[model samples]
Target: MRLYVTPASPWVRRVRVCIDELGIGDRFEYVQTRWPHAWGTRTVEMPADFVEATPVVRIPALVADDVTLTDSHSIIDYLDGKFGNHRLLAADGPGRWKAQETNALACAILEAQIMRRAELLRIGADRSDDFIAKMRDRGLRCFAALEKQVPSFGDAFDLAQITTAVACGYDDWRYGPAWREAAPTLTGWYDTVAQRPTMKATEPAETPER
Candidate 1:
């Protein structure tokens, strides 16, 4: 199996950490990609061959079981089903929905963060204050909501918890500590999660390779 990642993306980090927790790291060939940019430069460029392989040309793609898997959640589903850690998600029911909701919330943080990043990338004259503010507000709401929900996460370390932690880490790395003041509960959660070896190993650089 091959795991292609954009080192700076929390989406990719989610997959990487999942692979680690599943104990399947040995089966995956790690491939680093500089998507939406070329090696620390502002130029947007997906790897030529990767673009040819998938319509979306997104990173954190997995080539396994003789098929290509796109999207972070899809990969999570695959691993949870096969690996059956029993920690990634609930076995079924409203419990599953609760986990899914948390996962979606965490993913939403990244979505807003990515949007803000793209907006920032626009040439100064083209950037819109309204759009940037919208993204920032959206992210802020996500952080606040997740912070309130963190206590319910309890003692078990599951997929939702993992993703929530990744969301905070990504924000800290990409945006800044401004969120810390808003999401204090999540701030405490991240302090512990960041110490996990998987997280330490996959931590995003403050600046991407570009």
Candidate 2:
């Protein structure tokens, strides 16, 4: 199995952390996708060889078990099913529904973080303060809710926690780490979560994995 990823992507990092925590890293060959540093102003294209397998040209695509999984949620869910000794998603009932609900909220927060990141990457006049402000406001709203809910974060460290952690990590990486000040409780929770071996091992870097 080959997992295509980039070092700086939280989506890829979340999946990597999941596989590492589940003891399934040996089942995958981590393929670091590269784009031309000289693409200049044009949108980047998938490196030629990887284009066919990844329709969206995104990271965290997994080629495994005779199927190609192209999204982070799909990849992580598949890994959990195959190798999870302890389940990330609940078996059924309220716990399952709650996890799904929390995950959806976390994912929306993650999207806001990414949206802000896109705004930041634009150069000078190309950047849009309106978009950045909107995304920043949206993400902080989500963080505010999560901060109130932090006391309920158990020690289990399941999918909801995984997504929440990565969203916080990404916020710190690209958004001036202001969320730490804005959401003190969630920040405290993340400081503890960041110490986990899987989290420490997958902290984002510019260097590509071989």
Candidate 3:
């Protein structure tokens, strides 16, 4: 199996953390990708095979045998099913729905953070302060929602927790500690989860632009 990744991507970090938690890191060959400074402008030059594996050109793409997964959600779902026996995430029942709900909130936070980042990276004149403010507010709103859900997180460290932790970590890495103001409970939970070896190993960094 081959997993295409970039260290700076919270999406790719989620998949990496899931693989490590499942103790299946040895099962994959990691392929590194880069983000060009002209990210939103022109085509990115990625490996031919990676392009073939995911025409949409997203990172965290996984190619295993005959299966190709182009997104973090699909990759994590496949990993949980094939290597984790549904341990990372529930396979059915009310637990599955609950996990899905929490994951949705976490994923939304990640989306907002990433979108905010993209906007921030734009040239001064090209950037939209309104959009950036919108994303920041959206992310804070989701963090508050997660704050309410934290008490019910239990001690499982499942997919929902992994994704939430990733979102928290990403915000810290890219946006600093402002989010902690809105989600103090989540802030406490994340401080401990961030100590996990998997989280430490996958910490976000700058991906060199092309």
For all candidates, the clash counts are: 6, 0, 1
What is the descending TM-score order?
A: 3, 2, 1
Question: Alpha carbon lDDT of residue 79, candidate 3?
Answer: 88
lDDT per residue, candidate 3, 29-132, as tens digits? 99988778666545768778889989999888999997999999999988899888999888999999998899999999989988888788788798899999
Which stretch of 10 consecutive residues in model 2 shows the poorest summed lDDT? 34-43
50 Cα displacement, candidate 3 (Å): 1.8
Q: What's the true lDDT of residue 39 in model 1?
A: 29
lDDT of each: 0.79, 0.80, 0.91
Ranking by lDDT: 3, 2, 1
- Residue-level lDDT of model 2, residues 29-118, one tens digit each, is 888787543222456766665776677777778887678988898888778877784388876788878778777778888788767766
* Highest TM-score against the true fold, candidate: 3
lDDT of 1 by residue, 87-172 (tens): 68877888889888888888898888877877777775877889989988898998888887887786766799888888888888
Candidates 1 and 3, the one with greater TM-score: 3
What lDDT is reached at residue 127 by model 2? 79
Model 1 misplaced stretches (Cα beyond 4 Å): 36-45, 206-210
